[model samples]
Target: MKAVKWFAPHDMRLVEVPKPAPKPHEALIRIESTGVCGSDMHYYTDGRIGKTIITEPLILGHEYAGIVESVGADANPALVGKRVAVEPGIPCLKCEHCLRGRYNVCTTLQFPGGPPYDGALAEYSAVHAAFCFPVPDAITAAEAAMIEPLAVALHTIELAHLMPGETVAILGLGPIGLLTAQVARLAGAGRILGTDLLGYRVDVAKRYGVDAAYNAQTIDSVETILRETNGRGVDLAIDCARSTLTPAIACRVARPAGRCILTGISGEEYGQFPVDIARRKELTITWCRRFRFNFQTAIDLVASGRIDVRSLITHSFPLEQSRDAFELVSRAGENVLKTSVDQ
Candidate 1:
């Protein structure tokens, strides 16, 4: 099998390794496509995100889709030949969190494409069969690979406890942020406002159902959103920028008692926000980790055409050109939203 492995900062190589076989409850998949995620870029560019450092050669991809080439003895034989979107994180079902259906936060969770677990940036991957969600023929391989991020967005919306006709402000127009805005819109958010430092991203957000998109570099995003909301701010604010400033801005732009959700992965170990403003507003702040039990919903949303993720896939590269894919996403150039590696 051929895989892309990270050795050091800005260093990734295509190497040959033994193909893996499925365990008793697993399936061996021939990887068809893999999305280059923000976390992949963080590892490729900075060699780390907080304390999760690349201390060893690690394959760097997680959001992926593939065909079930074979199944283990105990795995479902019917899954063979099916195209599936893989949920990359495997949680320890024995943990309290997992027992309560909150497996995304399981203390002993095993996530691929990080330090220890190799990811699906290769021709093949063997994953637990239960985590592989089958998609209808209507979903393309690229779209299937996107279900992971869509799941994250869905989880964030769920955490927000969004309601019909409530206003929402999404602070960031990256792939996740744009998807979050779309999900919020479909959830019946009255008005969806999106912001990003880049104008192109703002423009992209507008096309994806945001009522208004603002470039924070050009104007005060919090103030603008408040002004449009009659100085009361939005009913819900979600920060997907992972920047130190956006969470605080989310706190500022949320109405009194409004809910705020943080879904971005911060580079810094500790983030400081405007606690005073948050306290005064009596805000209900929540943090979102990777999705839990949302992959099926995400697939259904995309498969049913309720959410359009195809447009967000601005670039695609072959598995052999994985390095270029990482570079394109890392530089955030060419108005790229999501970059995927086709196998």
Candidate 2:
């Protein structure tokens, strides 16, 4: 088998490796496609995201889809020969967080591609059968690889508690941000705005059905959005960029009694916030983590053509060229919304 391994920062290599056999209660999936995520780029370029450093060689993919080739003796035979979306995080079901339906925050969660565990950027991977969700025949493997990010988008909209006919502003036009914009529209948001520093991304957002897309570096985002909304501000603001000024900007551009959803991870421990503004406006703040139980919904949306995940997938590479794919994502190259490695 072949695998993409990140030995260290700026040091990923495609090496021949042994095929992994499924353990009891597990299934071995032959990976078809694996999406390169923002966190994957962060780990590739800097070797870490905040305190979670990659101190050892690790497989660098979690947004993946594949076909089940074999199942362990203890695994359900029904899972074999199914096309599935791989859920990368496995939590300790006994934890308080898990019990509360917040398993993404489980204290003992082991997330693939983050640190200690190997991930799905391989010809074949063995994962717990419970985490694998069968994909309908209507969705292609490339589309299924993106279900992970779409799941994040779905989770973000759920966190914001967006109401039908309400307006929304998504701050960032990256893969997750743009996907969130589309999901918000699907969720019945009346108006959707997406912002990014890149003009290409802004243009892409518009093509993806965003009502408006703004270049934050060239325009006063808050003012432009306010003017467009007749000075009432948006009813909801979702920050998909981990900018230091995003939270305050979100507050400034949102209406009183509006909601703000933060989906991106920041390098800094504490970001500056306009507490006074939030207090005066009575804004609701919501935080998002990796998706929880949203994959099936994402699959449903993709299968039904309600959410077009294909528009977000702009680049694909063979597993042997995985380094090039990572470089393109890390550098934010042109037309590269999401890069997937095909095994």
Best by TM-score: 1
C-alpha positional error of residue 216 in candidate 1 after TM-score superposition, expressed in Å: 0.9
Cα deviation at 217, candidate 2, in Å, is 1.7
Write down the lDDT that model 1 would get. 0.91
Instruction: Give TM-scores for every candidate, taking all chains together and pairing residue i with residue i.
Output: 0.98, 0.96
Q: Which ten residues in a row have the lowest lDDT in candidate 1?
A: 264-273
Model 2 residue runs over 4 Å out of place are: none
lDDT of 1 by residue, 120-153 (tens): 8999999999999999999999999999999999
Q: List the residue pairs that clash in candidate 1.
A: none
Candidate 2, residues 1-343, lDDT tens digits: the string is 9898999777889888899989998999999999998878778887778778888898889999999999999888898999999888989989899999899899899888889888888899898899999999888898999999999999999998888999999898898898898888888999898788878998878766689899998999999999989999999998888567887888988999999998876655678899999999999988898899999999998999988888788899999899899988877887789989986
lDDT of 2 at 138: 82
- Off by more than 4 A, model 1: none
Displacement of residue 157 (Cα, Å) in model 1 is: 0.8
